[model samples]
Target: MKRFVQARAAAFRGAIGAALLPLVLGGCATTGINKGQINVISTADEVKMGQEMSAEVAKQYTIYNNAAVTAYVQGVGNKIVQHCDRQDIEYHFAVINKNEVNAFAIPGGYIYVYTELMRDADDEAELAAVIAHEVGHVAARHSTERMTAMYGYQFVASLVLGQNPNACAKLVTDMAATGGFLKYSRKDEHEADELGAKYLYAAGYDPRGMVDLLNKLKGLETTEPTKFDTWFMTHPATSERLARVETEIAGFAKLTSPVRNAAAYAKIKAQLPK
Candidate 1:
């Protein structure tokens, strides 16, 4: 009898997998399909969650703003956005009124840059590297991957905690803190670098933006790790990654068609709050 029950359970699991196959396959018809099996969450769901969390964070912290700085950031972001295929999503770029040299992205195209990052950046191209990297996170749907993974874990967490459905979800979201562990696998990091590099090149920013940014961050780490923020926590900048980024940029011959916007960057820096 036990053997029969086990066989039935196996059969049921197989059936469910088969049924889910169509939903997964047909999901490509929807927007934001990049690679297979990595179903992009709906824009509505992404925006709702991102906006909620973003609002909470913004309320918790303050936003730094100056017309010049704000305009420069938006301009850099817009240059990269033009190269992206996902235009349906709303993208906003702003500097957070914080001392940390970091940048992060939310699911529905919400991105934040710390004033510290802007202040430390040598040129607009360096800022482009930061923007492109954050955009890669949104484009690849890393946020959704995190939420989906957490949901699967919550299913088991619910059974163990013996909580009501609503309570379980809240507990799971808080405990998992997807933003913290949104740290991707190694392959994902490499892919993001490639994507960032490509965007920088296409956006008319020198590919060296990536290399320069990585090197600058490396120097900062030598002085102190606590000085940097979201970039290090979310994305690693190892010596190896720096070497590869340099090599990658060396291959871009036409990138010199236009140079970094140094004057615009300096003008924006003057407007930042003390």
Candidate 2:
């Protein structure tokens, strides 16, 4: 009886794998950012998917209730949004009330930054750099690609694009917060940094802001490990990442007068809760 049950289980597993093979192959689609890269979800579907995930994230994290701080973050995010590739959808920027230094982007244009990250920035440009980095992820569709690759394109397509189901949103929330689901690959991180620097410069903010913020993060890794853990946990920091930002900044041939806007940054930072 035991042997018979084992055989049946093995056969079931094989059948499941065989059934999924065609869907996985058929679901593969090319990315808009790079023709060589494949993505499963379409632009419209990705937006709806992100909205659902954002709603779930909101349930987990508290939205900072300050109007002034939220407005400032939105203002900076909007500037970078103008320089992003996906301009069709409106970007939503919100501040989490948490004191942790962190920020992340959902598949669509939704981005959240912790108030601590805002308070820690040296200038408006640094804050813009963080927001721009998240924008880079959305523009490159890294989150969507990551999801499809991890859970087969067909499954993801059925969940997000096919039906506006709660199951897809729940899966996204679980994966994003816990497992390494939403965590970007090293290549993805580098690409985001590159695009972010370009957007930073294009938006009239110094691309060096990216480097400066990274340096600060590296410093915090030593002095305030717990505080930095929120960011470093998902977006691991390395010397390579820091060097890449510097290299990107160096590549800029003719840089305009990039705005650091120290005064504006100070005013905004002051608005955060004590």
- Highest-scoring model, lDDT: 2
What residue pairs clash in candidate 2, if any at all? none
Give candidate 1 regions above 4 Å deviation. 1-30, 151-181, 229-231
lDDT of 2 by residue, 71-104 (tens): 9899999999998776767799998877677888
- The positional error of residue 205 in candidate 2, measured at the CA in angstroms, is 0.5
Off by over 4 Å in 2: 1-31, 161-169, 172-176, 179-181
Give per-residue CA lDDT, model 1, range 185-237, as digits (tens). Answer: 56667766777787888888888878888888889877877765444545555
Give lDDT: candidate 2, residue 202: 90
* Window of ten residues with lowest summed lDDT in model 2: 1-10
